[model samples]
Target: MTSSAPAPVAWAILGFCAVALVLRLLWLSGQVRSSERLVTYGLLLGTASGLLRERAVQDGLADLGMLSVGLTRQLSTVVMVLTFAPLCLLAISWSERWPARQAGISGLVWASAYASGIAMLVVGTHARSLELYIDRAEGWQTPVYFAFFSGWCGATGVLMTYTSIKELRAGDLRPIHRLTYLTILVVGAWALEEALSIFVSSVCAATGTGGGFVEFRFRANENNYIYLLAGGAMVAASGVVSELARRLRIDPASRAVRQLTPMWEDLIAACPEIPRPANPDIRMSSRRRVHRMTVEIRDALLVLGRYAEPVPDDMGGHGGEAVQIVRALRRKQSGAMPGQYLRLQASAPGRDVLDEARALSKITKHWNDARKCPEAIPSLDGDRAG
Candidate 1:
């Protein structure tokens, strides 16, 4: 990098990197605690570092008077690989089942990639005069130094592409998974370009065979086309990831909670103590709030069950999930101990709670409607008798 500005293409890529960073940060906010989470984190940090390097070149920071000449440029360039090395580790570890063997393989490969990145940056720093330009036939360190960084990128690309393909073939594949595969594929193409550039440039430098390659208008002797395409792919992947994150979002509000809301409110209104918070943390999402409310209501219903007049004919046996829960509530109210009620509860499983809630809602809806109109039903004096 020199005092002169980098090409317009680099500037455009940097702009895309900024967007990618923003999207990755949003993705990280989600609740997925898996290896893919680590991958997204690494991508965020790496893209930010890329932006740092691009800014160093775009602004010609080497020419600044207050700062040491070439200091910012070198640091930014080094940071590029430093930040990306972790992504290599995370990418390789993205498989569903990480057995001991797979874990060991990923660890060794990550170590190699990270060490090579560091060694590359160090070798570049110790170069003569710190001049950024190095033609294919010019210097030994340039090709060798680039080879280290390229190797890591190539390895990472191969791992991610393989992982994405497996994910694509997974049963009941989702929209997010598909977009994630697309992102990995685009990045894989970019990595191939980088590897090809290293091979071609190193060959030219080694054999002293210099023919005209597809050089850039601004950075002559450099494969600007490769970088341009790579940067564009990254930007596209960023958009795909953003869409994936949006699609994969888990709505905190559960359907059970929504249908049970009116019933829950009415029940708690009669027995205020039933609505006690399960946890002190008030910062949970709306869905969590609904779940907590559902729990409280279940407890309250058990108490109400104690006061249930008798097992109505329609509610006996496996009439309906809702009535069955109501019957259980009545059983609990009738003098069944905690262990008895818990045994019944465990039989239902968590998945059926929503159906139970819906049935309970119907009962509450009738009660509320009657309560709203005095003439609709008989006296509601013993509704909360328990």
Candidate 2:
């Protein structure tokens, strides 16, 4: 007698593929950065593999339309292997910061599993004569096909599990940890399902005659679809929760906005010459005496005589204090002595002089350097002479 397993299995796989597609699309919609394109690639690979596997099993052939079904089975196996390799690398990379070595190890693990699976598929296809021997209960050789496929999935599942737990323990918050955990659980479930699938298929392959316990007609595809739907929902839900957590930690302000707001007010107070954007100065006064005094003080530094002690007074009062502190620091001395920089009680006026003093001190350093190293100074006369 025949069985009804194959039809429902086919439909279930198709339905799971549709839902996986939806979840992936939703994920891609939220991410816009070019650096995040890996996520898109992974989602595409996984979805394509599942769809291809479903097509191969249900259609009983591949798109290439080879008369032999063995080639299609091998192709499906390859797709499954290729789909998870990048994901495993991503998981390892995410776990450790800037971990090229860890990612390489993850790749190696994936490669080993992929190789083993392909090798078994080759062996099973070529040695079709084993089916009869296996039916006669020919020991461990009977279960070699099942064992190979199960081992391949189990290895990946273990790596994903380790990575998830490692990251979670290391305080990776919100979306990253949650995403990893969901991936781990999905991989574990897939591994289990693969084992079950192999067991059932192996039984069918081994027992050439019908009526052995585990029949090929036993359908698990519907149940597998339900599992995938649940897994995908969990993963997407975790991502949403992570996004919320990120928002809580860091607000929505752009980096420039965050940097400028605190410092702008202070700068405006320190440098009154910096005209307010709203009010360009409309009036000009015959205050040449005031401007003349300002220019004289600025030019005074340019003419400080040689072989004189770099006068501390020329460096503004705060400048003098900064020089003293630097000397003390250089000597490895630590104790508060004279004037120290402090943000003070009065916001508008108390620290205004200090800002001015600091500016003059900086200019004073330029003059001091020139006095000590005249050769370092560029001369207009020298360029003309050249």
Candidate 3:
């Protein structure tokens, strides 16, 4: 049978799946646990399976002698089945705190189920061609094969739906996390669609009737399967995008650390009482380093408080604070005697360490510029002599 031209919606769904596949791969490239990797791989495979359903992709594979329509269908089905194993593991992992041994056993069981499904597909179905399968060749094996496949898919769908719903019902989920679970629900729906399609097709084939409500419903579900898969993939991709965006926002902490380093060093050097971190290693993430440095700078400011001179109200911004800090550093370094302890404000009020770092970063910029133009910094001697 000649393959029909792909509909516009089919192309759109395929395109969406392809993009989601790329995004999931990129997300997997970052730091992830083994279970996270498994789930991500499953998502990638599911998206890929959706893409494989496109007539264009099948034709391309056929052109390369890699896949005929029949083989493409089989491969897509197998990959989708494979996708559920990892997903099943993910659902189990998410639903409860299982011991490693229990988790491993669960994974193995899912793997065995996936293998069983593939074995049935290979051994039970005589027809490898799509036309033969769809045309309802007279055979008990075909019905049995579909029955097993449908049952496996249905079980997987039920598990996924259960897990997703349970997680979504929790009160503490962030909006993005809630969205991710909702997408998993969509995936579960897709799985159920597949199960229904397979079961109905098998029943119709067995009954030798292809032109009624049963056939119409089967065709409708079959057509919707790829769209459902694509929708799930797109939502999952959005979750990945959200994660990446959050990381991108945090990544600037590294730059902030670098910017504040000179100011931090100057303060620490002048106030030798400031204790350094024990493990000042490169392995620390940017956010942690920024927090540590912010705390250290604040402590150093307090230690050098006695040498600090109050800046005029007119000079009260970050640049003014930068000037005050610079003068205090000079006074402390010059061995000036402690006077009335006046606390110097070096940064604006901030909500968190990252915000504090950003505030301090502005001071560091002004401090660096003042050092380059020494005349811009008010002298400690001028303050001491006053």
Candidate 4:
């Protein structure tokens, strides 16, 4: 703002806006479609406009000529002017609890915002003429432009805070509480900062040394410090948003699920009766297939559990459940049905799919080898039905 120069905070705000844009794009990459996403798009555009304005002033575009300064002023007004649409979309989405009435209310807000934005754009051409500048808007221009800017940002901030709190209260798992609250607080803090800036500019206009209609300005260092802090807040929020999107994306290549493949293949080969999922999607997330395989494996083990011969009293718990299977198999009559008698005693594969699958593979190897031993066990028909 000093000598028509941009503050470092202006650059920081631009960075924050870029961070927000990246986060929104990442979130969208997961195929998330909603009004909130639309809001993100609007915010992205608004922030982009803010960035251009900052750069315009920073590069001393105005020093080139009066036409350049006018363009710079127009750019400043346009920055907030661009935010209304996305903020309104957010407001509409936030009011989902009362859809019938919410749409009407949101429409009104939207109309008012666009109307204000158009008016500001028309009059804002004279923004450079005002005595005092706030966020690059002059004294007379500041109030009109921020009236719209503050409304959009302020309303969205409140709604988002409420949404985050509601989600926190409803969620049962405690691990996510940190992310949820952090998102809410960071967003609220940044919104409050911008909203407060609007008010500060108004105060400066009324009470500063300008005597009601003279240009007022602040030191670049002081302004940059505040922008940097606000930008940091936004960057932190962007990180959280990025992580949340990543967590929510469908995992088409799950390492744990892939590990289960070797074990599952062996199980099905040994016991063809283990039902496979019908018409599985080749591109579906591996987690889904993992679920089906784990369930069938559990069922197959239960069937085998019935055929298990009594553990010899001499054996000491057979080195836990898995080793017991090997010992019992090695000692069973040639006719014993290992498929029916085998017990799945390890952790269910769904929770620790990779770990359990590897363990199962080891067990599978042992069972296959034991079946080949000289016991010459008879087939199911050769031995009496258990």
Candidate 5:
């Protein structure tokens, strides 16, 4: 008697499904309003369907238990059909350009395929199960059952893949475009598995025996399990990529374009003669770097302003004292500027960075000079003017 291969892969698949569930729960509990949350739900539902189907099918096979193979098959078929609804909803909700007309058409197609497939599977399986289980034991061959599963998965796969690719190409969620591409690729793998299963079952029936076709049967099953594992992990991974991109604040497209698009329009309205250049390449990275440097310098000045007393001049040279102050402040400032500016730059840092550093240094000098001259200390209004 030939037996099925070891189930180590199935167990591993279950482990990932469990991890995915835990991650979803953690994300939902967090305070951030994240689109990742929606993707997480779709992923959990997809993987849970696989897990339960496998468990139900295995239990039926092992013990001829309360759940028959026919019922398990029907349950799995229904679950696979329902899986697309959440995924479709996720794609539609996240999409900025999924227009009402496009969405309505897509919805009708998905609903029809799913409804017809489930309906046929239910009716056919019930007919075969009247006297006995409608699975292999009943010698029942309902092409409609397989056709429904095939059609539902095929339609969903095409719709989601097209929608995801279009959304990315249209530059929605530009920073997370790679994740979107990965999602479609992963879903394509699932479509391939479903197609393979349908093909294998049909070939087995035509051949009138499982001989010479057992390998395809095994491959088809393995692909299903692999598809679930890879697809679930990819969805969760895409969610993580999106969150990480947001945290890093990296815009994949032209950040300057995104920023100055509205600002420039307003500027043109205010000043008509301001000629807009044709193909201007405004690199925002330098501007961002300078803005960050300014923040660091301000923070350093605040730290240095807290010092009660200065080190004695004899203890170190004037330059050494300056370096000490810069060092003491660097910890708070997170090394925004050079500890020894003369060493770091042949000329000086960039104009913006140097200017901010100089401004901070001047403020510190004024505060120290004022502390030394108590007579010069002014009232609140004078202080405010200063």
Candidate 6:
């Protein structure tokens, strides 16, 4: 069946899929061998192939003689089978801590199933409108064709749902990963529902009890495709947004690391016993590096506190603490006697480790000036003596 104008929902779904496909493509460009890439590949294949099943797209292709309606329907099923390959691989790679050999064996089994399903679908089903075939086609072949397709979908859905649930239960997932798995869970549930519906409809047709249910099932299946495609696209778009958020966080931490490096070096030099990992892991993320540096700086400050004099009432805040820290470093370096040990506090209290890094970054700026003229600040002991 063809319509001169497609439904408004169809256009909306198509537009959403197009935008999502573009974002996934952009994300894929930067990824290398990650789960995100596998998910993106699945979305790309599913979305692109799903367009073929749209009535408007099929009508257009038929008009141009590029593909008949029957051919488009068959091609959509084939592409769907192909789309699951990447998704299954993702599930296998994530859910199993298995060695490469075992993972490969599992992959091979899934590959064979997919290949067999597609072969059965193409060879058993005739080149006729799928809607009509499902509604009116009478034969053992018709039910068998639908059984294989629905069974494949059911298996895929079960696997995806199981993997998603397993991952979610592991806890401590990043926000992006949590969102991705939740999306998978939703899609898997929908797939299971769609598979069961298709299987029941096929059985009804084979048993001559279809009645008006066939038409409802056909329309329901079409709606299911729309939901599936739209859901996939939205998840891909969310991935892009998540990537941007991650960059925003890392970029500032990276800048803070650079800003605090000099102060960190000075503190480390004064407190040699402050445990610095001789060989820091180069692969640590910027946020982790910032936390590590903040902790080490705090440790060094505690040790240097032994040489620190009390801060004067006038020299209070972070600027004052920065000035006192410079003097403490000088006293330690010059072999001065260990005197008062005043606890250092930041001018602005931090809410978290990253905030603490930013607070220290501000202190480091003041420290640069204090180190240049440490003698200008009078010693508390000198004041007491006077």
Q: What is the lDDT of residue 375 in candidate 1?
A: 31
Model 4 spans > 4 angstroms off: 1-32, 35-43, 56-67, 80-113, 123-126, 130-141, 174-177, 203-253, 267-277, 286-386
lDDT of 5 by residue, 145-202 (tens): 5566566566666666777667666663535566857667577556756655764564
TM-score of each: 0.54, 0.44, 0.60, 0.57, 0.48, 0.66
Clashing pairs in 6: none
What is the full ranking by lDDT, best candidate first? 6, 3, 4, 1, 5, 2
Clashes counted in candidate 6 amount to 0
Instruction: List where candidate 2 sits over 4 angstroms from the true fold.
Output: 1-41, 55-64, 102-114, 126-142, 169-218, 221-386
Q: All predictions: root-mean-square deviation over Cα?
A: 8.7, 17.7, 6.8, 7.8, 14.2, 6.3
Compared with the true structure, all predictions reach lDDT values of 0.52, 0.43, 0.69, 0.52, 0.49, 0.71
The true-versus-predicted C-alpha distance at residue 336 of model 4, in Å, is: 7.1
Question: lDDT tens digits, residues 1-386, model 4?
Answer: 22223556466566776776677666553544455455565656666555545545535765666445555545554555556565546545655564567657656765776687677666555545553244444345556656666666677667666666776677653466658566765676667565566556654554443433222223432244335435533643554465564366534325445544654554455455667766768866455666666676666555545455433344332123444443343333333544444443543344455445555544544444444543323234423233
- Model 5 regions lying over 4 Å from their true place: 1-5, 29-38, 53-57, 60-65, 97-121, 124-141, 164-176, 182-186, 189-193, 196-219, 237-386
lDDT of 6 at 228: 64
RMSD of 2: 17.7
In model 4, residue pairs whose N, Cα or C atoms come closer than 3 Å (at least 3 residues apart or on different chains), thus clashing, are 9-227, 131-214, 131-215, 304-340, 334-377, 334-378, 335-377, 335-378
Q: What's model 6's lDDT at 141?
A: 57
Error of 3 at 171 (Å): 1.9
CA lDDT for candidate 1 = 0.52
Better by TM-score, candidate 6 or 3: 6
Model 2, span 155-223: residue lDDT tens = 556666676666667773557547757767667666656666656555555564343443332344323
Cα RMSD (Å) between model 4 and the true structure?
A: 7.8
Question: Which residue window of length 10 is worst by lDDT in model 5?
Answer: 377-386
